[model samples]
Target: MAKRCVPVTVRWSDMDAFGHVNNVQVLRLLEEVRVHAFEDLRDHGGPSLLESGVVVARHEVEYLAPLVWRLAPVPTDIWITAVGGASFEVGYEIYDAVDGAAGGGGGGPAAGGERTVYVRAATTCVAYDLATGAARRLSATEREVLESWTDEPVPFRRRSR
Candidate 1:
């Protein structure tokens, strides 16, 4: 799997009265993961997606377990799910390494370790032309970069028929 694993720090403020990371804050964590991945891609022959203007068209998130605050960063796995002319889909899994050990950074699960998934999510992102303020088709370089990280769709538990 060509996924990107990012270690995201959980802030104390991210917790809610119930003593777990707030549901809304989970989205923020996902954003952090994406930002890290985008930066990495840029350094490795990929387009500077942030600078070029990518917008979130939609998001689907499913919470499986409550994520509690911890000293160690949470391991988040993200990958490209689909690539379209002007849009793309990204999938994510927020999880904990087995025995609370932070997984190896970069990609994939920890060596011979299981993961306790906290959330599953997918985001639809559209490439935008900042000057024109309109959606734009992905460039050849951008498409190649995205395809290199492409993986299976998010295994969402619930889906509409």
Candidate 2:
């Protein structure tokens, strides 16, 4: 299947007292990505993805650094890392839109030149029937949409990889 990409924005509320994005918001950020993945999968979800039983089976996030940066504007970029039987994983990298680097990309005094900070996140989610509590597979149309959602080698350290 192809990778899916979604853009996410950092809201002022998303930041923390330290003047950075809060830890929990990253999960929400990842979820926003997954929601868009389903959106992509379902040809840009209208009501089904939400109406359907979607649940987060597991979530893991690696905070490379604190959310202590300021930005005039934010961009959105998230991906559907993988989709399994009734389950899927999502990944994201929120950074400065201008420089296009992860976590400043260097360890020297010149490192701070990057416009954005890289924060990689991965989450495992599941689709279930609310009434029956059974796993549900995405419909054919949805699969096609999901397959169209992203490019290859989605920046995720997946279980298979």
Candidate 3:
């Protein structure tokens, strides 16, 4: 997949006492990336589903390694892994940029290289009518926005869980 690069800075406060980013910080980082995605959609004159009461119904992340505290400029890649009728999933990978300065490596920095993180994850979220508390479908524009990010054919829907 051709992943979209989202270069971001790490806040000093994002780290925990261990001098590495806390596990919980992954959720926050993921959420930020998702929100940034909405901005991309909007810039393309696409619809954003964030305000439509689409909440995370599922989240699955595999913590690969610890991220020691750093000054700033972390590179995080984000992409639409899948888009469903009332839900969608996004994939993320947080990488340290130092190892990438010489410029070349996929996902994280070179194995065991400094300035790289190895954590990655995927999350699924669905839209619902806040007033009715029922599933709501995505708009055509939103669907287009999702498809713009990947070569994967759109996924078929299943009964809501």
Candidate 4:
């Protein structure tokens, strides 16, 4: 499946005293992209993962480079890394798009330009029954929708051997 490229604006407040995006704010960026992904899936005639009730079970983030405040929105690529009975993993890469490489329709970075990645991360999301307040198995429709967005896992630098 093709990765979804979402352009995320970095707010001035997201910057820390160190003059770069705060580590905590990076998670918020991932959340924003994930929410957009779910909405995009629903817009494309797929089941609404958000409406069905999903929660983040885990998040692994690697800070590769400091992201300074910029006027242009950052290009972020997000895709499904894994899917299981009740959970799925979403991988993300936040990077700088050289030239005019803005992805308007889920396409990745533009060709012929070097890009600098700021972060690589993944989130594990679990299906849940909000009515019962318990984890639930993934439905066929949900699984199908997720599988359609599947891609390779994030290549983290400090992954366990």
Arrange candidates by lDDT, descending: 1, 4, 3, 2
TM-score of 2: 0.66
Which stretches of candidate 2 lie above 4 Å from their native place?
A: 1-7, 40-47, 69-73, 98-116, 150-161
Worst 10 residues of 2 by lDDT: 98-107
The model with the greatest TM-score is: 1
Estimate every model's Cα lDDT from 0 to 1: 0.92, 0.60, 0.71, 0.88
For candidate 3, the TM-score is: 0.77
Instruction: Write candidate 2's Cα lDDT for 1-161 as tens digits.
Output: 34333556567888888777899887777777666555554454433665687777776666666764344433445666675666666666665544442334444565445544456666666777889988888666545544454444434443443
Where does model 4 exceed 4 Å of error? 100-113
- What local lDDT score does residue 112 receive in model 2, on the 0 to 100 scale? 40
- Worst-scoring 10-residue span by lDDT in model 1: 101-110
Candidate 4 lDDT over 1-161, as tens digits, reads: 56989988889999999989999999998899999989999899887888889999999999999988777788899999999999999999998666543443536655776778899999999999989999999988888988988998798989755
Residue 23 shift from truth in candidate 3, angstroms:
0.5
- From the highest TM-score down, the ranking of the candidates is 1, 4, 3, 2
Per-prediction CA RMSD (Å):
3.2, 6.2, 6.2, 3.4
Position 90, candidate 1: lDDT: 97
For residue 9, what is the lDDT in candidate 1? 93
Candidate 1 vs candidate 2, TM-score winner:
1
lDDT of 3 at 35: 85
Weakest 10 consecutive residues, lDDT, candidate 4? 97-106
Cα lDDT for residue 48, candidate 4: 84
